[model samples]
Target: MSAPETTTTTALMPMVIGEHRIAVEALSVLEILGPQQWVAIPNTPPMLPGALAWRGRAVGVLDLGPALDLPTLSAPSTRNRNAILQLTDDTVALSVDRVLEVCRAAADAIAPVHAASWVVDGGLPCRGEIELDELVVPILDLDAWAVASRRAR
Candidate 1:
């Protein structure tokens, strides 16, 4: 008999934004912080309304609501959290509703995003979708988001 095939699994951190369930690469996440006070900048895009101080540096806050066509987040509360993501050339905080425990799944389990509305500028920042415990979760692609965000500015 041939050798048993070894499946490759990837670490993912599940999070909630508005009513959407999504996940991010666990390796790319630097830290997760509770409700943080941010300084809102005037004349900025709705997706990027503010910045917060992190490790003595001003890190821009990214709100995925507008990007995903979801309603804007309300005032910060106990349930709100910011996930610091390490991008190619910078680090930014992603505002999320709630963060769930990290989980692992086979890499092939992810399927392409079927919702075309999620695409921005010819690309969607979502890597794909994966089903976990009967729930489908979209995987966030930070690198793609960073590139699209830069192009928007």
Candidate 2:
């Protein structure tokens, strides 16, 4: 016989990117850093705004706007914000407009995502969703987004 085991729940960390609010897996977020030095790289795709030095390494940053086909922030600055997103063995830095406060909710609190049912501002496909106080926020599918971005280039 085996004793019943209960699963522990952790809150979701949603970040505000441009006009969209997306939450990646909380643990996947390495750190949220204030704007750092960004240097433009010639011949890079629009999705890659620039690269920055972090922890003695050059981490190329991606701008979700163009990559996701979403509306970009009207006025982005060097002082914007960055969310270091890590998945599997891959990691990358994201330049977000701002990050919202951490929200407490079970993963079930979010609605299931569908390939056809989920759609963002630019008709982008989403994987999951959460109903925030004012609006429904979608969870960005980083893996899928990465695949699409590579195809776009």
Q: What is the C-alpha RMSD of each candidate to the true structure, in Å?
A: 2.8, 3.8
Please give the distance, in angstroms, between residue 54's alpha carbon in candidate 2 and its true position after superposition: 0.7
List model 1 lDDT by residue over 1-98, tens digit each.
Answer: 99999999999999887777788899989999998888777777787777888899998888777766777654342238999999897798988889
Candidate-wise lDDT, in order: 0.79, 0.68
Superposed model 2: Cα runs more than 4 Å off: 1-10, 67-79, 113-125, 151-153
Q: Can you give the lDDT of residue 10 in candidate 2? A: 51
TM-score of each: 0.85, 0.73
Best by lDDT: 1
**TM-score for predicted model 2 compared with the true structure:** 0.73
Clashing pairs in 2: none
